[model samples]
Target: MFSLLPLGYVGVMTADAGWDTIEKLVFRPRVGELLFNTVALVVVTVPICVVLGIGGAWLVERTRLRAHKVWAVLLAAPLAIPAFVNSYAWVSAIPSLGGLFGGVLISVLSYFPLVYIPVAAVLSRMDPALEQSGSALGLGPWRVFFRVVLPQLRLAAAGGALLVSLHLLAEYGAFAMIAFDTFTTAIYDQFRSTFNGAAANMLASVLVLLCLLLLLGESKARGNARYARVGAGAQANPSRLALGGFQAPAQLGLAALSVLALGVPLFHVGRWLVAGGAEIWTRDALATSLLQTLGYGLAGALVTTILAFPLAFLVIRHPGPVSKLLEGANYISSSMPGIVVALALVTITIHYVPGVYQTAVVLVAAYALLFMPRALVNLRAGLAQAPRELDEAAQALGKPPLVAFFKVTLRLTAPAAAGGAALVFLGIVNELTATLLLAPNGTRTLATEFWTLSSEIDYTGAAPYALLMILLSAPMTYLLFAQSKKVAGQ
Candidate 1:
C-alpha cells in the first residue's frame, strides 16, 4: 500500500500529457539544474559528514580525550535541532548566508551526527584484537585504522552516508530557507504557485530515481561481508590512543562543532524568546500546537513501528530475492521527500478515498511512509541479534509459532522496537513539509507553527514553538545516545 504512492506519482505523470511531458520536463535545463544542485549537495555534504562523524567518533571513542562521555552527548545532541531551524539560525545571524554554501554548512552541522552515532557505536564494539594484531605487525596507528578499522566501518559509514543522501534529496525547508533549489523545493514551488502537481510529480519521479540509485549504490557498497567474529571469546576493550599534543586540538574542534550545531540554534531561540516577551508565553495557540505535535508524533511512531515489524521480520527471518526486493521497495519510498509523499497521497486519496482526503489519518499515513525505514533498520538489527535457536527452543517446548514470538522473540526484541519507535516519533515531530500539506484544516504541529511564524518574519511568535520543539526532542535525543551506547556495549 505504501509503495502505491510512488506508483500514483508515475500514473499522474503519464495520465496527463503522456511521455512527451515527462521527456520535456526531464530534458529541460531546469531539471538539469535541479539535479545538479541536489547531487552537488549530496556529494559535498555526505563526505564532510563522514569525515566529521568518523573523526569525531575516533576522537571520542579511540583517543584518551578528556570528558569523552560529555563530548559524545554533545555530538549527538544536535539532533534536537532540526536542519531547518539550524538554517534559520545561521541565515538570520548572517543575512548573506543564503545559498549553496550556507545550505551545505547548515546541513553538515545538522546531519553529521547521523554518521557520528553509528560509526561511534561500531568503533566502540570493535574487537581490540584486530587493532592489537595490526600494531603487533609493526603497523602504525594511521595504517592500522586505514587498513583494518576503516574496512570494518564501511557498512556503518555507508549506511550513514545513504541516510544523509536521502535526507538531502528529501529536504525542503532548510534548502528553501537558504534559497537553494533542489528537486524537493522545486516540487514544493510548483505545488504552491500553480497547483500543478503534474510538474511536481515529474520532479518527484526524478527524485525517486535518485533515491533508487542511492539505495542501489549503498547495497553494493555494503556487500555481503560479515564483520562479526565466528567464535565466542571474552571481549576486551580497545586500547585508547594517546592524544598527547592533539588532545587540545581535538577538544577544541569538538567544542566548535557542538557550538555550531547546538549552541547557535539555542542562542538564537533564546534571543527570540526574550524579545517576544510574556505575551509569547500566554498564547493559547502554543499549548494547542504542543498537544497536536505530541499526538501526531505518538500516533505516527506507533503506526510506523507496527508496520515495520512484519517487513523487518520477513527480510531477516526469510532472506531471499523476494524479501530483499520488498525491503528495497520500502527504502525507495522512505527516501522520498515528505512533500512528494504528501502529493502522492493526495493523488491517491482524492481519486480512490476522497472521504479521507485532508484528514489526520492520511497525514499520519504520510508520516508512516516517510519514517518506516528508521523503524525497519533498528528492528532488523534487533532481530538479527536474536538467534533462531531461542524461537525453536520455545517451539520445542510446545509453544505455537505466535506464542513463541510474543513470549520469546518479541520480548527479546522489545528494546530495539522501542528505540525505533522513539526515532520515528522524533522524526514525525520534526517533520514540516507533509504536515503543511496533508494536515486537516486547522491542524498544527510545532514544525508547521514554527515555519508559519518564521515565514512571516514573526520570529518572536515562532520562538515558543521552536523552543518547545527542542525541549520535546531532548528526551529522544538522550534515548538515542543511550540506545547507541547500549548497542555498542552489547
Candidate 2:
C-alpha cells in the first residue's frame, strides 16, 4: 500500500492540474522527443541485452566453453559498476559520447546482468531429460534448444526485460550525464526550475503510464504457461554442447564483450585514480562519505529486510489468492522508479508530516519502497527451504510460536536474510536518483558525493568513490551469483 503512494501522488497532481493542462503538458514536441528517445533506448537496448545475456548464459552453462567460471564472473561483473559511472568512463574516454547510441552502449553494459543472472540460473538447472527426449525424436540440437529449452526461459527473460525497461525509464544520472533527454531527466529538470509544479507532475504521470504498460505487457506475454516438471526423479545435469570449430569465435566474442563492458570502465577509473595523485584522496571528506554511505546502506537494508519477512512468510507458507494478490501488490509498488518514489516521499512528508520532512526517516522509507523487492526475493527463497513441519514440531515441544520462529526458523533463514541485506546494501551504495532528491540536509553518501564531484568534471576527485563503491559491491555481487546457482538447483 505504501508503494502505491506515488501513484496516488501522481493522480492527485493530475486531478489538480485538470485534463486541459495535462493535454497541453503531455502533448508538446519536446515531450514527444523525450518519449522517442526513452522508448528507443528500451526498444534497442533490451533485445541486445537479452541476446547477449542468454548467449553468455548458454556459453557458460550449456557449452564446452573454456574458462567458463572466468567468463561467468567477468560477464556478471559489470553489475558492480553503476550505469552513471559507466557513462562517466565512456564520456571521459570519448568526450563526444551522447544521444541514443551512447545511452544504449552504456546501459547495455550496466544492466545486461539483470537478464544474464536469471537466465544463467535457468540454463544451469534445466533437466537433461527434456533435451534427451527431443533428441530421441529426431530433432537437431538447434531445434531441440529452441523447441524444448528456450520456452522454459520465458518467465525469466520477460522479468529481466521488464527490469531493464524500468531501469532505462527511471534512469537519470546515466542519461543526464550524456545529455539524453528522457522523461526522468526532463522531470528532474522541471523540478529544478519549478519545484514539483504541474510540468514535473505531468511528466511523471506519463512515465507512470510507461511503467504500467511495460508491466502489463510482460504479464500478458507471460500468460499462464506451466513449466514445472512432473513425475520427476532426481534431475540430471544438462549435457554441454560441443563447440568444435566454432570455439575460437565464441571465445573471441566474449573476450571482446568483456573488454567493452567491464574493461573500459575499470581502466578509466584506474586511470583517473592514477592521475588524481595521493592528495586528491582527501582523508576527511572520503571517510565521512564512506561512513555515511555505510550507515545508510545498513539502516535501509535492515528496515527493508524486516518489512519483507512477514510478507515472504505469508507467500511461502500460504500460497493462496490473497497471498498472491499481496505479493503482486508489493512487486507492482516496488516497480515504481526510484525517482518517483523519492518525489512522492518528498511531497508527502512536506504536506502531511512536515516535522519529518527531509529527515533521515523519510529517506530510509524511500529506500525501503524502492528496494523491498530485493529483500523479498531472498527471503522468499530462504523460507522455501525451511519447512513448516519444523515450526509445528517446535510448538509441539511446548515453545510458543514466536519463540520457535525466532530460535528455529529465523536461525535457518538468517544466512539468506543476510544475503538479501547485502544485495540491498549494494543497491543503496550505488543508488543516485533517490538519494540525490531525498537525502536530508548535510547528508552525503558515496553516490551523492561522487555525483557532485563528477558534475564539476573533477573526474580525478570522483575516482575514489567509484572505486570504493565497486569494491564494496564486489562481495555482494558474488553472493548474488552464488545464490542464483543455489536457487537454480545446480
Candidate 3:
C-alpha cells in the first residue's frame, strides 16, 4: 500500500521550489467545472438507474412481460462489460457519442442493473398484505402503489443509487475516452502529463469532499427498517398494473433503449472479431495477459473479502460512531478513483518503503484498498440480517465466541459473503487505471492490454480481450443477482 510514498516525498521536496505552479491547481474554475460535471453525471445517472430499477423490477416481477427471466439475465449481463470497455465500444461505434450524454449512457447501461437487481429482488420478496389492505380500505391501485409500494422501495433504491453515484464519482478509464471532464479525469491527466502531485492531491481532496456529501445524502435516504421478515412465507401476488394502452410503447421503448445501449457496442466488437480474427488471436501474448489478469483479479478479490469480514462484523455487531468511522474509512479509499488512491499509495511507498514500488504485491494491495468497501458494504448488510438470538442461543451452549461465529454466524452469512466476493472479483477484473499505474513492469492484465492496444489505435487487437472479459464477468453478475434475491428473501 505504501508503494508510492517515495515518489510523493520527491514530489513534496520538489514542490517546495515550484509551489506556485502547484498553487495553480488549488480549486480553480477548471476544478469547479470538473466537479460540476462529475456531480451532474451522478445526478443524471442515478435517477436513470433508479427509474430503470423500479420499472424493470415491476416489468419482470408484476407485469405480463414474457421471458422475464431472460430479461433479468440480460439486464444484469451489461454489468459484465467494464465501463471503459463499454466506452470503447460505444465510442468506436458512434464517434459522435462523446461528452456528458455518453457518460450518462454508458453509466446507465453499466450500472442500472445494480439498481435493477436489488429492487427486483425486493419486489420478488415483497408481501402484498399491506397493499391488499390498502385496497380493502378504499384506495385505488395507483394509490396503493405510490403510497405503500414506493415507500418500501426506498432502502433498496438508496443502496443501489449510492453505488451508482460512487461509481460515477470514481470512474476513470471510461471518462478518459468520452471527452467528459471530471475530477477523476483531471487527476489522471495531472499525474500522467506533468506528474503534478499537488494538483492531483487537491483534486482528490475535493473528490473526497464530494463523496462525503454523497454519503450524507445516501444516509438520509436510507431510512430505518420497517418490517424484517416480510415475504418469507406469505403469498406474494404483487398487484400488476395493466399496461393495456401503454403496452406497445413501453415494450418498444425498452427494447430500443436496450438495443441502442448494448447492441451497437456489441456490433462493433463483432465487426472487429470478424475482420481481424487471425491478427488478434495470437496465442502466447494474449494467453499470458489473460492468465495474469485472472490471477491478479481472483487473488485480489479473495484477499479483500477476507480482510473485510472483521470490519463488517465489528460494525454490524457493535454499531457505534467509532465502528461507523472505521467502515467509512474503508469506503473512503474506494470512493476515490483508482488513480488517486494509486498516486497516494505510490507516494507513500516511494518515500517510506522503496523496495515494494511497482511490484505485483503492491498492485494487489491497491486492488484491496479500492475494492474492500464493496465487500464491507455487502457483508455488513448480510451480517445485519443474521438473527441476534441465534448468537445468544449459541452462547447458551458450550461453544466459544470464535467457534460459534464460524459455525453459526459465518454459516448464515456465507451467501452474502460469497455475493460480496463476487462483486469484488468482478470489480478487480474490470479495473483499469490503478492497474496501469501499480502493476509490475511488463505485466499486462486484460484491462491494461486493452488500454495499451487501444492507445496504439489497435482497437481490433483489443476486441478479443474485451469480449473475453465480458464473458468472464457474465457468470459473476448472475451470482450477484442470485445472491441479491437470496438476501431480499431473508
Candidate 4:
C-alpha cells in the first residue's frame, strides 16, 4: 500500500489547494452548457454508432452482401483514423459543417467501428441455425431478426455502446474544432487560462457520476449470460441472405459513406501536405511538441501496463465486489473527459504538494489514469483464459509465486498484454487535453503542436505534424487489428 504513497501525496495535496477554484467553477452556467453538450454528443452518437455497427455486422456476417470479405475490411477501416484527425479533416474541408453537427459526423465516422467490430463478432459467432429453424417453423424474416438476432446482440451492443459513450465523454479535438463546448473543453479552458484547480475537480466529480450512470446502464443491458459467454465457442454456421435488388444501393451507400468518412479526410491531409511543403517543419515548436508527445506516450503506456496487471488479476481471479470496485475505479478515468481528470489532478497537485506542477510526470500520470481501462479490459480477457490448474502446476515444480507468474502466467498472457500496451501507447500518443494542461511549460506534443498551428489559421503548416501523428498511430492501429485477429484465430 505504501508503494502508492507518492501518487496519493501528489494528487491529494494539490487537489486540496485547488478547492476555491473548483467550488466556483462547479456552478458556472458554462459548466451546465458543457454538460449538456457532452450528453448531447453521446446521445446523438450512440444510436448512429449502433445502427451502423449492427447494420454493417449483419450485412457482412449474416447476409449475402456483395463482396463480403472486402466489405468487412472496408467497414472496419475507420478504426485506423484517430478521432481528432478525422475531426480536423472534416472541419477544414467544410467550414460550414462546424459545431454540434460537425462533431457528430466526425465522431460517428471514427467510432462506428467500435460498435461494428464487437457486434459483428457477436453476430459471427451466433448459431445461425437457430434463425434458419425459426424460418423453417413458419416464422417470418422480420420475426426471426427481431426475436432471434436482436437478443443475441444485446450484450455486444451494450459493450460497444458503452465504449462509444466513453469515447464521446472524453473527446476533445473533434468537439473543440466544431465549437462544441463540453466538460472536457471547458475544463481545459479553465486550467490553461485561469489555472483554477478546485473548479476542475468539482467538474470532474460531476463527469465521474455521469460515467457511472453510463456504466450501470451498460451493465444492466449486458446482464449475466451475455457477459459470461463473451468468448465461448458455440457451434455456428454462416447464414447468408441474398441481396438481389438491394445489392446495388447497399454497395453504393456503403461506398459513399466510406468515402465521405475516410477518403475526404485523407484528401484534406494530402492537400495540406502539398500546400505547406517545407513551412510546416521549420517551426521549433513542432520538434518540441513531437518529443513531448513521444515521452508522454512511452511513460503512459508503460505505467498503465504495469498497473493493469494486478487489477486484471483481481477482476479475473477474484471476481467479487472488491475486484468490481477496483475495475470500476479504473473505468472512471476513461469515462470522464481527460480535461476533467487533468483538472482534478491539477487541483490535487496544487493544493497538496505543489511540487510537481507542469511536470512531465504529472502529464504522463494523467494519461495513465485516462487510458488504463483499455489495458485492464484487454488483459482481463486473456487472464480469464489462464486456468487455475496452471498456477498449481507451476508451484508444484518448485517455483515461487512471482516466478510462477512470470514463467507461466505472464508468458501465456503476453499477446494480450502487449495488445493492451499498444492500445495504451496509441491512446497516449493521440491524447490532447491532459497533455495540454499538465505538460511542462516548454513541452509541446504532436497533438498540441497540431492544435497550435491550426489555431493560428496555419492549417497548411500543421499538416506535417498531423501527418506524422497519423503515421505514428497507423502502426499502432495495425497492431490492434493484428492482435484482435490473433484473439479471433482468424
What local distance difference test score does each model get? 0.87, 0.90, 0.80, 0.77
> How many residue pairs clash in each candidate at the backbone level?
0, 0, 17, 17
In candidate 3, position 200 carries an lDDT of 71
What are the TM-scores, per candidate, against the unseen true structure? Answer: 0.94, 0.98, 0.88, 0.88
lDDT of 1 by residue, 1-490 (tens): 5655665576556567677878886789999999888898999999999999999999989999999989988999998998888888887788778767887899999999889999999998888898999999999999999999999889889999998988888888888887889998999999887674567778878887888899899999999998886565447788999998998989899989998998889999899899989999898888899999999999999999999999899988999998888887787777777887888888878889999999999998998888888899889989988878999999999999899989998998898999999999999989998888899999978899899888888888988888888888989988987787777665
Model 2 Cα lDDT, one tens digit per residue, 301-328: 9999999999999999989998888788
Query: What digit string (tens of lDDT, one per residue) describes model 3 on residues 1-490?
Result: 2223323333454456465754676547897789789888998999988998888887878777766677777777777778888888888878787778889988898888878888889888888777778999999877987988888888888989988898888788888887888988888888887674666766766676687788889888775666555335566577666778777876776687678656866888888888786867985778998899889988988898898998888898888998887776676556666776787767767877889988987888888888887788788888887877788889899888788878888999887788888888888889888888888899988888888887676888988888888888889888888877876776
Give lDDT tens digits, candidate 4, residues 427-467.
Answer: 88888777777878877788888888877778898788888
Give the best candidate by lDDT.
Answer: 2
Clashes of 1: 0
* Pairs in clash, predicted candidate 2: none
* Candidate with best TM-score: 2
User: Cα lDDT of model 1 overall?
Assistant: 0.87
Residue 105 in candidate 3, Cα distance off native in Å: 2.2
Model 4 worst lDDT window (10 residues): 1-10
List residue ranges in candidate 2 displaced over 4 A. Answer: 231-235
Model 2 score (lDDT): 0.90
Q: lDDT for model 4, please.
A: 0.77
TM-score of 1: 0.94
- What's the residue-level lDDT of 225 in candidate 2? 92
TM-score between candidate 3 and the true structure = 0.88
Scored against the true structure, residue 421 in model 2 reaches a CA lDDT of 93
